[model samples]
Each structure stands twice: as structure tokens, then as C-alpha cells.
Target: MSTRLDDAYQWANSADGPVLVAVEERQDHELAAGSHRHARGQLFGSMRGLLSVGVEEGVWLVPSSHAVWLPPHEAHAGRSHGPFHGWSVYVAEPACADLPRRPCTIRASGLLREAVLRACNWPIDASTAPLAPLAASRGHLAEVVLDEIRTSPPEPLGLPLPSDPRLQRIAKALIDDPADERDLEQWAHWGAVSARTLSRRFVSETGFNFSAWRQRARMMRSLEMLAAGAAVSAVALDLGYSTASAFIQVFRRTFGQTPAAYRVRL
Candidate 1:
């Protein structure tokens, strides 16, 4: 973990409550909090950046339009891909019964976002009652927030990272520069493994061959770049796609929206 994120993690350290909220307004904020567990489940909402959240299953790329729900005691770590502005809502056991049991990213609906943002300002200590009018209302917005999470749509935008050291290094290199068009044989040479060995390892570790993994990496990166306001053609070339049209085809297929459409929605 980077020293900067280590510092950012400080904001996340709080007393677990039936509902606890922490807001981070800095665009460059990030945290790796490490492969640690929290007694309460958490909802991570990113307002303006891409977040790379890692758990036991894999790493998920969360764009600005999304949020991730992590069940209780599930070891996880997170880092920002760019400028990120977000907050977290931690809910203790029974209160989190309605949320997803496994790690998954959900679309942050406007209502859910408002509920979370509102909760951030009020005291979330369930032991004590809130005094604010908005918070003191009879509707009990906290439950509303969790209900919104339960119904929100899930997005299939995560690119799983290989756990094995050799494959992990290769995955990182490719993610760092998706434009690199190195073949499996060339990457095998860099890893000091036979091409056959590397190919076998790639499938076993991530369930995706080299080419497929690279494609997924490129597609995920394109979402981040697009969220940052990059032009279609520029993002395409940056991610090693030959042309804007080709990139558009893949992007449309992967995300079900054109780059322009996606940005407009964001």
C-alpha cells in the first residue's frame, strides 16, 4: 500500500455501528486498508473516480456511477485509479441482513446517494438518537438506504486479478499499460517461464487466457479513462485498440452503452 493511502485509511477507522458513515471529499483520496476485516458490512460509494477494490474472489473496478457492498468480515483492500470523491456506510450485522452476502458492485441510484450523503452529516451511532430534523424524521432514512442498496442493479465491470505471484506480476504489467501488445511467449520470457507453462497458469489462476485477460483489462481501463473525460479515439489508442470504431464496438458490447452515452449518464 502507498503511504498516501495508508494516511487516507485513517478516515475509515471508526467505531462500528448499526449505521456509521464517513465522508471523503478530496478528489485524490484513496485507501488500501489492507486485507483486513470489519465487524460491520460497508457500502463504498465513489462520486467522481474509479476505485479498484480487491477481495478474496477478485479485484473489482468501480467507476463513478457505482458503489460496492462488502459483507461483514470479508477481507478486502481498495485503491483509487484517479481522483476519487466518496464515502462509506458501515452497518452492523442485523441491520445489514438485507444487503448482498457476497462482494458485488451496484449502481448508485440518486435516492441511495442522497440517503448516504444525508447519513454522513448526522451522527450514525445507533446507541444514541440523532437530533437533526432530517435525521429525526419518522421515516428512518437509514433503513431506506439499505433497501435502496438491495434493489440497485449490479454491474459486470470487474476484472479479476490472478493470485499467483508470477501471473499476478504479469497482470499488473498489462494493467499498467494495456497498450502493450506483447504475446504470451514474450511475456513468458519476461517471467522466465515456458510459454506452455505460462498459458496453463493463466487459465488455472484467472480462468482467462492471455488474450482474453488483456481484453478485459483494456475494457475496464477504457471505462476509467472515459469517466475522466477522455475522447473515444484517444482512449482507444491509449488502450491499444486500432481505431475509435473498433474500441466503440468492444465498449458497446462490454458495457452496453457507447462512450458518449455512458459519459452523458454519468
Candidate 2:
């Protein structure tokens, strides 16, 4: 963790109240708050940029329209790849027991989005804000956020990295270039394993077969480019899809929206 980035951490760890942090990031700015845990749970989201959160299982690709929920004391590391408008709510375990116990990506609805922003505006530590003097007001706002989080639906935007070094070799190759159109047989060379062995290891370590994981990697990477204002056709071609329409079909099936519609919200 960077020394200068302790403002949020300090606020979150201060006393028993909840915390709200708003980040204004630069395109070149990289925030790598290494793997750490807190007594409280956190809800992380962004209005811009990409969030890569790594837990014991794998990494999650958080887009502008999505949020990630971390249960209390769950070990995780987060990094922002580009300049992003990030916001989060940190509440003690008691305030979030109603939410999911697992670390998962959530599809942020309009109500959940506003509730987080509202919490930001009413930081519990700020003395000058209208509700700054009242601790009850802060607790109430956090409760609202908790309710919304429990109601928010989950999304399949996570990219699960395998634990084995052999699988990591293949995973890294695809992450470096999602357009790599190689099948398991072709990728086996990178991992120094037979094609069948690689396939079995992928399932054992990542809970996904080779083909399914490759598509997930491509889709997760597409979110960053698409959110950064890339055209649908360009993103499709960049991700190795034969055509924009074909890419749109997969994207629509996964997110229930086409690239154009999804980017408009960003």
C-alpha cells in the first residue's frame, strides 16, 4: 500500500462507524493496495477505469457498472489499471451480515449506485457536512447500503486464475493477448503439459475447462477497452472475434446488453 493512499484506510478503521471513500485517479496512476484484510467489509465500485481484485480463488474484473463485495476479514488485493472514479463503503461486520458471505461481483442497479454516492457525500468523519454531527444518520445510511447490496444481483465478470504454475503460464499468455486463437493443444506448449493434462489441470485448479476459461478471459478484458470508449467493432476484432456481430452475440448473452448500450452508461 502507498503511504499517500492511507486516507481511506484510516477513515475505515476509525472507530466503529462506516466509511465512504471517493477516488479521483489519473490514467497513469496505479493503485496496488496489496493483499490485506480489515475488521469491516467493503463494497467497491467505479464510475470509470477497471478494478482487478485478486482473492484466494481468482481475480475479478470490475467494470464501471459493476461492484464487488468483500466479506469481513476476507484477504484480497486490489489494483486499478487506469484513471478511475472509484467509490466504496466500509462497514463493520455487524452492518453487513445480511449481505453475501462470499467475495463476488455484483451488478450494480441504479438504487445501489446512488446509495454509495450518497454515503460518500455524508462521510461519518466529516464535521462540516449537514449530517456530520449525527452518528445515527451515518449508521442509517450504511444500513441502506447494506440492504441494497443484498438485493443487487451477481454477475459473471470474474476471471479465475489457476493455482498451478503450469496453468498460470497459459493463463498469463491469454491475458497478455486475448486474441490468441489457440486451442488447448496449441496452449499446451506454453505450459509444458500434454493437451489432455492441461485440460484436466484447468478444471481441477480453476473450476473451468480450457475453452470456458479462455472465453472468460476475453470477455473480462473486453470490459476495460469497451469502458474506455473503444468502438464495438474494434473491441470485437481486438478480442479475436471473427466479426462485431459475433462478439455482440456473446456479450449480449453474458451481460444482457450489447457493447454500445453498455458503454453509453460509462
Candidate 3:
């Protein structure tokens, strides 16, 4: 783990602090953190590059403009698509009562970003009386940060996973190769389940039907590829889109911007 991540874990495990912020800048190599859980909820975001966070439920792609929220004690892991610059805010379990209860991708508003950057300068320890006023100010700032997080709208950056072993096998396969180009009947046969059952279960377990879920998988993968400097046309073809136009349309609908524009921002 990087120093910032280690500090985040320490702050998260400490009951003495209600909230703490950790900032990191890494340009040498991509980041890959192993699965772990802490006693505190985390709001993690990047100002540059893309990050993917995974939990038992699914994976969420965190673009530079968005953040992922992990409720307290949620087992999760994270990997950056490329060089990353980000911040993490750890909120004590007791202080997370009003936060979102599930893992999700949220808009990282300007106000929230500024508040976190400011809070980074506050003292990490809460026990010192001489810094009591600073600590109080930090507490109020934390409240603003939390409120911004609570009010920010969620982004459709997550690909939810199914619980059934059979469905899970299929989900993994699709994530491994989003360009598989298999129909429902084909996938159902591979999973050894009837097409009707596969279709129904996908909706019941993932809230998305087979086709929709596959498209979402492709979209998420495209985000990572694009962030890594893949050409827009190449990404479209790699993800099984018949034409660049089709991919561009989907990308625009999902993110309100074309892949090329997103890459420029990165």
C-alpha cells in the first residue's frame, strides 16, 4: 500500500477521530489495492485518471469527475486504470448514520472537492486541547463534506453483479471479454440454464436484463480503455460495437460526452 493508503487505514481504524482525509499523487505506476474492510465509511475520488472499485456486489468505475462511496465495513478493493491523483475521506462508523448505506458512484462536486482539500490541512489527531479549535472547525467542515456527498446525484458508473454461482460465472466471462457477441440462448446454454430462467434471474438479481447488463459491462470497460489512451474507434470495435458511431452514441447517452472528449479531460 502507498503511504496515503496506509494512513487512511490507520485513521479509519481509530475511534478517536470522526473523520480524516488522505491525498495521494502517483505518476510512476498504476495503483492496485487488495481487498480490505475498515470500520469507517470512505468517499474516494480522483482528480486525474480513472479508478475502478470492486466489492462483493459489483464494480464501480470512478472517473475524474466522480467518486465512489463505500459504507462502513464494506469489503472492497481498488485499481487505477493509469497514473492517479486522488483523495480519500474516512468517516467513523458512528458518524456515518446519515450517509448512503450501499456502495455507489457519486458526482464529485466542486464544493466537496474544495472542502476535502481544505480539511487535508487539519490535524489528524483529535486528542490535543491546544488544537481543539482547529478540530472543531474540522468537524464542521466534515459535516459540509458529508452533506455534499449526500446531496450529490449518483452516476451510472457501476456494473452490478449477480449472486447465483451460475450467473456469476457468466458475469465474469462477460467482464473478461465484453466483445464475446453471444446471444441469450448461447450464454444460457453455456451456463447450463434455460434461456427463460437466465433472463428472469438476471433481472431479479442485477436489476438489468441480459442485453442491458452486457451493454453496461461493455460501457464500463470502454471507460477504462479510453482512460488508458485507446483510440475511440478502436475501443468501439474492441467492445463489440459494430461501428464507431454506435459506440459514440452510447457513450454520449451514458456520460453526456464522447470518448474523445473524456480522454482530453484525463
Best by TM-score: 1
lDDT of 3: 0.76
Ranking the candidates on lDDT from highest down gives 3, 2, 1
For 1-266, candidate 2 gives per-residue lDDT tens digits of: 33324545655554443333432323347667788887678788777656778887776556566788888888999877555567777766665657788888886766777767776665333223421333677567666677777886766647667767787777877777889987788889767889888989889877889898888778877887886678889999999999999999999887789888887764
**Residue pairs whose backbone atoms clash in candidate 2:** none
For each candidate in the order shown, give its overall lDDT on alpha carbons. 0.71, 0.72, 0.76
Candidate closer to the true structure by TM-score (higher is better), 1 or 3: 1
TM-score of each: 0.77, 0.74, 0.64
**Best candidate, lDDT:** 3
**What would you estimate as the lDDT of candidate 2?**
0.72
Give model 2's TM-score versus the native structure.
0.74
TM-score of 1: 0.77
Candidate 2 residues lying further than 4 Å off, grouped into runs, are 1-4, 18-30, 46-50, 56-59, 80-85, 109-147, 253-266
Kindly give the number of clashing pairs for every candidate: 0, 0, 0
How much does each candidate deviate from the true structure in C-alpha RMSD?
4.7, 4.4, 5.4
Question: What TM-score, to 2 decimals, does candidate 3 have?
Answer: 0.64
